[model samples]
Target: MERGNRRNALWLKQVIVLDSSLLIAFKIKNDSHHERANALMKQVVSERFGKPSITSYIFDETVTGIFVKSKSLRLAVEYGNELLASLETLEVSEEAFREAWKIFSEQRNRRLSFTDSSTLAVMKIHDIGRIATFDEDFGNIEGINAIGLV
Candidate 1:
C-alpha cells in the first residue's frame, strides 16, 4: 500500500506515536524516567492519549537501546516481539524521509537525530498531534503535544 493510504487507513486523529525514549524507559528498570513512563502508559491504556502507535524507526531504536543497555539479547527480542504484536507500527514513507532530511539539514540549534527528524516528519504527514516521549526535543515543536515530558 502507498504510504499516505496506509496512514489514512488508520484512525489518525486519535493515534499517538510512541517514541524510543519512552519505550526504553518503560522497559529498563534502572531508567530515571521509568516511573513516569509507567504512569504515562497507564494514561495511554485509559485512552486519555488515544490509540498508541510507533514508527518503524522508533522500533529499531528501542530494541537496539534495550539490547545495548541491558546486555541481554533475549530481553531485547522479547520486548521487540511484544511491541510488534501489540502496537501499530507505521512505516516511514519516502516523502517523510525527504522531509526528515530537510529538517535534519536545516536545524542549527536543536540537536535532533535523524530518527527524531523522521518522527516529526511522520507525525506531520499523518496529522498526528500527540507523542508519548521522554525526549525534551519534541517539547518545542509546534502542533505536537509531547506527553510524559516535564
Candidate 2:
C-alpha cells in the first residue's frame, strides 16, 4: 500500500526518524534500553530501511546526553561522530526551529523535553511516522510512532 519497496508491507513503519533517547541508549551500555537500541541500530545499518532522519536539535540532545553520561567531552564528540555515520540529519529554517523550540518550552510536562517536542514536530513536517526511541510520550503524538521498545 505504501507503493515502495516491500510494496504491500503496510505493517512496517517505514521512513523512521531517529530519536536522541535511542541514540543515547546505543552509546551507553548501562542504559536500560541499550540492548534493544543496539539491535535497532544494527537493523538500521544492516537492513537500510528508509533513510532514518534526525533533526539538528535532536543531534545536540544526543551529543549532550552522551556528554552527561560519559562526563567526557572528547568521548561525546567521538560518539556523536560515530553515530552520525548511520543516519541522515535534517535541517530546518531558523525561524521554524525557533518557533518549535519556543512552543515546546512553554509546555509544563516534565516527561517531554523541548527536544522531544522538536522531534515530534520534525516527524510531522517530514511525514516520518516511526521513530527509534525509548520515550513513550512519543506515542502520544498523533502521527508519530516510537519504536525500539525494550
Which candidate wins on TM-score?
Answer: 1
Worst 10 residues of 2 by lDDT: 5-14
Note each model's CA RMSD in angstroms: 2.8, 5.1
Model 2 residue 52 CA deviation (Å) reads 1.7
Writing each residue's lDDT as its tens digit, candidate 1 over 70-140 gives 99999999999999999999899999999999999999779899999999999998899999999988987
CA deviation > 4 Å runs, candidate 1: 1-10
- Among these predicted structures, which one has the highest lDDT? 1
Model 1: lDDT of residue 59: 98
Query: Could you estimate the TM-score for every candidate?
Result: 0.93, 0.77
Clashing pairs in 2: none
The sequence of per-residue lDDT tens digits that candidate 2 reaches over residues 36-130 is 88889888766566557678888898899999998999989998887678666776556556766875877655467777777666665555688
Per-model CA lDDT versus the true structure: 0.93, 0.73
Error of 1 at 47 (Å): 2.2
